[model samples]
Target: MTAGDELSDATAEYITANDIEHVQIVGGTGAVSADVASALTTLGVDTVARVEGDSAAAVSVALAGLANDGCGDDLGLVSSDRVALVRGNPDGVVAAAVLASSLAGGYLVTPLVVGDTLPAWVRGCLAATPRNIGADRLNLGVVAVGGTAAVSEATMEAAPDAASSTDALTVRIGAATDTSRDGAINADDPVRPDTATAGTATAISATASPATGPVLSLCFSDAVTATDNVDRVRDVVEVNGIAAVVVNAAGNAGSVCDQSRIDVTLGQTLSAGDVISVDGSSIKLGTSADQRSFGSATATVTAPARDRVRPTISIVGIAGAATARSTFEIAFGDNVALAGTALLANDEVRIVGGPGGTSPAPAVSVAHEPGASAAVATVSRPLRPGDRLIVDPGAVEDGSGNQSAGTSGSAIRAQASPRINQVLMSDLKHTAHATWTVPTGSVAGVGGTGAGITIRAKGDGDAAGAAGNGWSMVFDRASTYSADKPLDIGVSVDPKGKRVTVRFNNGPATATLGDLIAALNGDDKFAALFSAGSPAALWRLPTMRPVLCWAWSRLATWLRASATPVAPSSPSR
Candidate 1:
């Protein structure tokens, strides 16, 4: 059945009534482990156990043992060789044991330490006291019916013939000090004085002892003597009883005789009371007279030598005829020095060419010489284009200065002069005519019809005005008849009229018109003028038979005021 299927009624009732915790089954058996566990758990069992083994029979044997034990614990079978008890349910325990025994040959019973807690099913089987078989020595064999009995009866036994023992050896100390003593007296004797008198006889006594526990006494005194009475003595006794000598002295020369000569140096110069020790002992004394001397020595001194001074001069910008006469100044830096010797006059001075010259050339002149400030004394000379002045400080001085020429020099070209010219508009010439034409239906004089005017610029030359040269123009207004109509004319100039003019009928117009036109033409202006708008209302015929009509009577008056031409005689009629 699928894992979802419920347990059979008989199995479920048996598990519940018996209080079985879990059921264990071999995986290869007809009953699947998970299915059996689920079935038992559904009836109130909560755990299951699996056993590990090599064969199913070993596993079955282990399960059978658990079943006969009367335990109600969940049991589980793991690897074909081993079984585990999961809970304390009778069915689970029995099933686990039976399964383990069935897989006996494949099963391996793991050895556990004594007192280790076991699962419920295993514990129940052990509590039943199962019979034991001779499978205990087999490293991985299952105990099936006797697993618990065999484990409970096992014990750890020690091997036979084992023992331990101990032993000791003797140790001794060796002598560390010499037993042989030289014929010497110990200073520790009460009759011996620790301090010796200077320049007098005194005694030294010492106690000698063996370093090993017991010490022997040698009471003898050695005469203490000093060069001066104030000497003091210091002595060290060796382990072999030999005494070393040292000495010191007080201010008085006769105080300690024993130590008086302890520090004495024979034949060598010393203060009268200097301490002198006997060949083998220590003693010291103050000086009988003060007589010690020392001398002082002297040290040497040194100074740095002075450096030789050299002077140099540099010059620039010597060029052209004018520049040839030009004096090129030379500068001397503080680092330069001048010799007292005067530079010969007329000594050649080097001149370097400037940008004005085609190539950099070194030119020499006989006019200049070195001056006192380490500079060359130069006289103005005419220079050529591209000529530059440069000074070289040679071994010998030039009369120009005490200076010598520098290794390098520089120059720049003279700035070119600027040329300027002014031209006037009057100088400009107009090659073509400046003409204006009346519009269609318009007359050249007087007011015309409402036709516009046209202006044409044929050509122009010398736009810049020159002296006595200017532009001229002619304007014509024609008369015509039109009712209630006035003629208007407008003019303008481009580029804000810097050079433009206006005139009427070939004559100068009034200031009013001129001003208005000027304002209109002033830097982009436009202006217009209109004739009187009043129109003539009357019309009349001419006295002559040819029949000429006058639009206004003023026309006759206007014609009379004008100059008329005389008529010539007609040919034979």
Candidate 2:
């Protein structure tokens, strides 16, 4: 009722017909004036009282023949958990009252709507209501009457923790989604605020509560019909961008009038920060005014993410072979993000490396899509068989803005590179001899396999190397030997003459053979091919025959064979 208004005739008649015993006017003068309650006194049937939101106001009015010492401390509502979390929305309260209260007593409790700010009436009731000292503690057992959304855990935790007396009103909150308790019912409406007229472009301004039975209110430039109205309303009205089935609709004025408002009672309750929208352009209003709809409009969603749990990450998979820029696929258990100042400032999504020899060396960067649980990270260096992914702490967050813990992912696989193996040099067709250089492990990294060595052999007439495939040393018998004549031929290498000189030998034949061997062995270039003491079988017959001849040649010349040829006389053959 307004400041000077009285109860309507219909409401008065309903009150009388219902055989109601008590009338408790809720709210202060600002809401319904005292004059509205006076009508109840005139009926002369039962008690009339007023309960103001000012929970602890002192009044000194005298009343005779009435025992009014004070209300005792028997907080007699059978909620095993001391706290009776009633619905904060009016529609929900009405539903709860109808189910829990007797017709004789009037139920008038202001709804709790705001997220962080508790209603004054709620505070007063909590402070004044006596708590049950069960479960070995004196704390409030917060039981969500409907769904957890009925009263969010975050919201209820913000309430006052102390009563006016010595007892501390610490709260023990349970799951808000818990529905096993008594009086749990799924309300059939979503958040329905006051009407938003299309012509007026009136911005919606009302808070909704109760996890079940949410309400959302909207107005068309022209009135809509009741036939198939719910279906029509659902076609245009949406919650979070999806069409929602409307359970009820009425005009704002009166139920009897066709213009009576159609309040939205969603089958589910409204969560904090939910956006409700209406496609006014698609609506068909039944009126004489303009049929133009109220374009697209958001119902309202005005709170930040208040999720209570933190997010965590795990590696789902790696893309192909790991390389310097390998993609490490990761996942968090909830919707995650890496945007905004908080996320960016802390490098919310980054890959890290440790002291171990890891593939794709550290200092990795992370990327994520909005409202997704998955992400990809880029590594800095070539990946090794031992490479594993690690995420930095506070690198990502969930929808509730909870940061993730430092996490490690599964190991990445390194590509197996091709290797070289050789066989032994043997005439047999199936010999198993071999030789090689590189092994097969982690060779093809981000830079890929490197260029290997190339080799080619010179043919018989090819330019080959200098000195025409190198120098040569050939030996031969310069002169023939005889038995009677002393050895006349001795071996010597003539560097410039290019010949093996043979003549009479005055010293031991072995000395000459030693000289040839010494000269050949002295040169480092020839040592590899013909070492002084190599196996004789490995050498050619021509080379070895000359050395044998020189080794045992008689110490005589060809002319002085018989009787030592007197005075250099020629010997007869």
Candidate 3:
């Protein structure tokens, strides 16, 4: 029942030391089991049997055969299972090993008809230190199990309901002396409540071993059952003739060993098959204990290393362009060095948005700012209103070599005044009597005025060539309409109190074109236009091209000569 090597060696030593004559090894098929058999025979001791099995049932059959023979007291049964046994006998002994293979099969069923002798053999291994002392030298607590009054000194007490028929029960015991070790309970150890109590039959199917006290829990074979008009209950179960209440209505059946197999207070990790000995009332592993340890103990496993956090980029400050160049200040969440020799070449720092107002934005230059925490990016072009600049992160790494976070850049923008563009002039066609042009000062909508041009016709009191010189009308900024008829132009004062105009026409001798142009300019109407070559005559020059132009119909052309109108105003949407 003990471990492989220790079982064989200890038994042999005890036999030789005590001058034993006869021996029997039962129920084992391991190398150590065979060695025990061989060593006994070599020592001139008679070997009775060597039991072997492929399963628990087969082993039970083998044990039954040997128990029937009833040959020796010092018997040996060997197996690789966790069972351990060490019994002392002055005359003879029977030792056996229930190896690892058959131990899991649970119960070792014996001859049903046989009495105590067969069941005792079925009890199999008992924990102890093998010695040549008399059987009385080591006292074992009195224990018993099922069937009519099988346990000695059991008393029956009143239960709510006692079965009309005979009931079965299981029982257990502990050391009589406080100094003695508590008896070890094995799995399938037969137990029954006191027969004298009124209750149903019950059995114990668990192993219970306490670490250091006389305390032991005895469980019932089944739940408390009711019979007749009452509930059956066992009151007290006597061990060694002392009445005690050890019966539990609810049974806890399973392996009941200390959570820690061997006490670890001595700094020794316990394993199965370790040779154990009792030294001064304490049990411990032997020097030659088998090194082939048992089950795996519960423990925790941890990782060795962890990774660092990645760095991130953020915008420190953004300022409007004071000069032609726009600048942005940027910083990183972590201290980082440029990836390459220069900031622009560093793949880590990417200029996500090009220069603010530069048409084909050029590459931006970066300079480390006064504070080591941030840097400045200078764009080559002047920033325009509503311009956005972006900088993204790439291969930048922190001091610990952790790469910067790959994400969108912190954006920045510069400011400027609002402006508008002039409408294109080629969109219009000319008529036979007059030509039109859009002036440079005009803007879209109500923002800018039509200016910088004058309109004059040849029929404007020029007696020398009155009939041949047709009226030449020069347009200012009035390019926002599409029509076959003449576009309307009126006068209005701007926020700055300046008069703006969009229309002009030929005039008669009493009010010549030169005189009309001078009058409009004096009123802060359209841009001033007087011929430098001849102040007396208002003329169009080749250099004075229109900014935006549109043609008027022939019918509308005659109306301008009769009207002495105010300055022209910007067209409506």
Candidate 4:
């Protein structure tokens, strides 16, 4: 019976009358039941022949096998090389069955089931068999039938080799090779991958360290993956031939493929001097149609050496005078520049130590001229006295791209400036003791003995009752009480005018009676020259009145006495 669960009496009678001897079963057990077979056997039918397949595609392939085999050329006319590919779903398979069989009347057409990627089995079948023309490569064409999406682009790619190598594979949308909406097709530049076993490596570079995380870049001459994919650097590439030990496929290492460029992060930290080499064969460019191994064809650069030596600063300064805040200057001993776009001013410079030093000073920005030494930085807040500055190990680089070794500078102040507090005897004699704290900063650069002030001019007020008879101190370096409004600050003994002049510094218009008394007593020179009733004393000079007296805490005073109040070992810290 052509198709029936139960045969009609006429068909049975005809079968019996004709004395059918050999009955053949088609379409497997699903189409013809055992009962029917038994019935056939009972009807004296023997030597039953059956034809079936594991799946619809398999059955179609079997049908193709049974058809007349012929050598198909690149012509549109059908022959044996036609392949019928279906979607992986069951419905897609059953639906495409009729199209596979008809093929303008059962011409040898291959049927295949494929999903996301091209089926490996199909590639194996095609690559193993050469074209009927005996050519190593065949020109193939795909006539997509039924609804569109019947076969994937990858499957169509396999079609050219087996069907018509030079013909463009037709892309379809809705249904039928004819009248169906067309999908994108690049006739000028087909989807054919290059014949090279692997892509070529254009160049390789190493950035030992930068504001951004360190990375090694290996760029390729072709697209490696279907999309952008970045993972462990050691994945596609295995580091080799380098000075240091580098593991392959390290879980910690990372890499990304952005088309042709492969940015990599090695498992190990790259230091000042590292020679890196990537294995040429280890690169995963892509495999051939037959699932063969793939690697880079050639590497433009291998074993690129890392930066040598750390950067050093020649001149490092922060407005030490407390006059300048939020700004500092540093000049590298060698030609220097900032490195990496990822660098933030805050990342490059870290304020270490105190109120300003240890605090998280939000750096606004850092500006620098290429090859210039100093880089100016602006901060959100003002920099404090204890705020010390240091360079990040990798932020600053020399002309050669070597990273900075990292360094810390002293407090932002000129010289070891001191804050003094003294007490007087009130005996009208220059006899007093002083105490001061000298914060770390500034060396003995054109100033007092680092933190010491030398006493000059000796002897007490003259007994002759002159106005300026007392030995007085002179200003080593003239200074001002303030920068905004100029207030002269210094002490001088004018013997020609018979007067001792002193301009108080730092604050207030002038020195007071107590302040003058304290200065004279605080100095060893004043104590020796006008100690209670020594030659001439402040109270004993009836005709002489106290003159200008500048009290110095940090400033240096020139006098005849060789003694100083305080001596700080560290001029600057």
Candidate 5:
């Protein structure tokens, strides 16, 4: 009897007393030994014997003895499920009991067996501790019966009425209006009350007259449920401007009449602010009044018609240029100049007959000389029909070449002069002999006794002189020539002497003396001598002068004498 045996005995006793369904002995030395197994068999308990370590033969002999009571099969025996333990040492019995029980319902009890060698039942018990026993109940079908005693005590303390019976109070909402009662006055149809306080009401049976007239009749039962001491009854009635008084209850006064009864008559139609009340309590029918006017009207306005006139036109000057010719051209109608023929100085000539009433003025051109009565040469070309022309009176030119005005007789004169002697000598000898002087010099073929012989002289020789040879003899002596050369000669006599000049062989020669002077004064050979100065000399001609001077001098003098001047006519007043 060691502690291990004691533990095993205690476990077996507890299991047998509680009738546990399974008992497992795990890890013990020896088998249940023959005696322990016999004991369990005698007690009529089924046992499973298991062997461990090198004691299987001995365990088998004990199991055989224990088998005599039919416990070998009924009380089962076996080696370890471990092959090594079963083969090497199988002497010990580690036993477990499997009683009748539901696997789904029962718990497992596994006992610890202290030994190095274990039987199969002990090893199976060790394995079955985790496998067969449930960690928690598989089905929680049973109601839990667990609770602490103090929890019941606490519940009893919290609810003192738990042992008592309950009763209820019944309150009906809006129930008063649902029923009628005797001696209850009807003030009006009752509106639903907002809250359930002790007592506030308007009696539902009341009636008041319609609001159309000035007098309203309110009727109510004499009895009311109001608890206030003053007991004022208000009739919210719409009425006209009539005063109403309370009538006697039940329509009876005294034998004749009652002082509590009153009548009403309306003065005007009812409006806002009319009310009826028994005391301080009153009904406000309405607050605001509708407004109206006796006579009202509206008028619509319309705009007036527009009267627009087109622009007009005029001419600025009569016999002068227009102020604005360009402006007038665009504003005028076709053939506008003919239409504006009456346009005078400063006359406003309005153009007419166009699409709109507007028309343009005709452009006019006028000609006038400034400040002169002479017929003004209106130098402007005449305008063709319908042509616009402008004439500026201020812009005028005179025949005297003045732009503004000139003297009436003002005329241009030719200032050149012409004379025969002024003609060049060479021109007279060659081209214009009638108007010019002949060359005064020797002729080429004539023979000469003096400087050269003159083939032609101005005059014959003069009278004789004192020495018995006449003056003519000396003149002849000077003028005599032999035929060695020919010459051309000219003679001019003055108070100083006579000069006889000869032209010979294209060279000029001169001889001067008294006899040649007298001969030149006789005027037989030359025509006449005109004196240019006081000495009275004749002009000579040069043989080689240019020809143009002779022709121009004669033509100039003839033209000057034959020219005529024309006078201009006066302007009209």
Candidate 6:
């Protein structure tokens, strides 16, 4: 008999007085309350049974057995190993059962959702027959049962050796969505199959741990219609005339946006809304001033989905050129993904209208700067004043798969600088000399007349190469000097290569100056060298160094004084 309330002593007594032969409980949790079970026993009604869950519903459909077991077309009558449900109102539950049974294949496996509005969908399904759903609509249904490791009776052993009666059953349920599910299923909800299993018994669960509720199941009739609702299907088991419902709790709930989600990688620890940039295959946070950013997301994600956006380019400044080497920077609109093959060369940049009748286009190398939404490109050739650069289409791409378009820019004038290619040393006619090759090219000296150059020789220790008097020598031709020209340094110009060579002569010494020569050649401090190119480039000799030139002068003096040794070793006599 169907009853909404619990059966008590009064109900039992009434049943006994009527001389009822047996009792069968249907619906309403699928099991009679313990009080009612005891009451019926006291009245001597031994034949008591319950049909709940899918089994109760299946009884009505299977009453007329099919000529063939697999011939039934309805989700209710079809043979399925498992069924998932979305619990709702009475009508919704009934409709869910009918829908599951009607659509269930040999095995109906689908994630279903039930909520206040699911009943209407069910009604629609009932109104329409012979309509087939796409395979994508229904998930393969699975029945998972879990609870405290403890069984209600000692008759059954625990499934695991370590299982204790106190152990709680926590089966991890996986969801199809990436977001976490929370507050969907409530406590003590029933979980059940939509139809009976092969054995004519429906699997069901009735107790949901109040602490951890079940994740809300998803139900959808079409792509446009879907819901994640608070509905539960009990995990039911009928054995020994006892209809048992296993408890299931834990429902996941969240609103899924139409856009996709992504993981984010940041240069620094992430904060909410921090900008993202591409650095090869990975992503990192961009600077606040960096306007170029793919998008923003929670710091937790290593990479997140964003609109496919292109990067914008801006010129920071131009450098190099005077020395035949140039460098420039291009700022991006935002930080981007630059991993894999994402970051590539901007082949569109070309140089035009530069001096020397050569392509002003700089041979450049590209690199992404960390924490900045900019890229640095270094050029191999010098830039002329009139040179202009044109960036054709497809110059660069951002991490988010955005490519830069064509643009144009003018090269700014830069000062010229002298570069020392290599140094040369020699001993010609007993005169130790050093020569420095400075290529000035089109770079003029200060005031545009000529490159002003200076060469000073200190005695390694003193201010000049000489010990007693002319310790330092100024090689500038413009400087005044005695006719003797005691200083042995000279500066000359090479007009052909547009080069300057400085010569330092230790003076004609008949005696060996090997030690001093070695010092002069080895010690960069042997001389102080300086130069000012037209525009002005700062450079120094790599091997030039400070040394004990004063000591060398002393040694030279001693060498000259001993040159007249009367009779060397006239005798250890």
Pick by TM-score: which candidate is best?
2
lDDT of 1 by residue, 1-573 (tens): 223244667766777788876565443334454566556665677776654343333344454554434332333333322333222223344544454444544332322222123433334333333111121111111232234432232221110001010001111111111111111111111111112222211322221111112111211111122332322222321221233221222121221211211221111122222222222223221223211111111111111123243454444443433334455545443232344464433434555555554344544543333445444434334445555554444644433343444444443334465222212222133222222222222222222343222222212212211211222222223243321222123333332322232322121111122112222223233221111111111011111111112233644454333211011111111
**What order do candidates take by TM-score, descending?**
2, 4, 6, 3, 1, 5
Q: Which parts of model 2 are misplaced by more than 4 Å? A: 1-306, 317-325, 335-361, 369-372, 412-573
Query: Measured by TM-score, how close is model 3 to the native structure?
Result: 0.17
RMSD of 3: 47.6
User: Every model's Cα RMSD, please?
Assistant: 57.0, 47.7, 47.6, 37.9, 72.9, 38.3
Candidate number with the higher lDDT (4 or 6): 4
List lDDT for all candidates, in order: 0.29, 0.38, 0.30, 0.38, 0.23, 0.31
TM-score of each: 0.16, 0.23, 0.17, 0.21, 0.11, 0.20
List, residue by residue over 413-432, the lDDT tens digit for candidate 4. 55565533222122232222
By lDDT, who's the top model here? 4
Please list the residue runs of candidate 6 whose C-alpha ends up more than 4 Å from where it truly belongs after superposition: 1-310, 320-325, 334-340, 353-362, 368-373, 382-386, 398-402, 413-573
TM-score of 6: 0.20
Model with the higher lDDT, candidate 3 or 4: 4
Cα deviation of 204 in candidate 5 (Å)? 99
Scored against the true structure, residue 117 in model 2 reaches a CA lDDT of: 42
lDDT tens digits, residue span 340-404, model 6: 44333546555565565364345655665443556665556655555555666666665566676
For model 3, the local distance difference test gives 0.30
Give lDDT tens digits, candidate 5, residues 41-67.
Answer: 554466545433344433433333333
lDDT of 1 at 421: 23
Candidate 1 wrongly placed segments (more than 4 Å): 1-309, 318-325, 334-336, 343-348, 352-371, 374-381, 390-410, 414-573
* Tens-digit lDDT track of model 3 for 1-573: 345644456666777788877665545665246665666678667544666665433454455455434531333332221222222111012222222224424322222111223222323322111111121111122112233332122211211011111122222221112111111221112222111323222421122222221122222221111221011112232223333222222222111111111111111222222221211111111112211111111111112133375655554323354554455555655422333322222233434443454455445666763325456666555434444445544434555566655543333333375333212221111111122322312212111233323232212222112121222223332334332222223333232432234343322212222223333334432322111011111232122233222333532453343333222222111
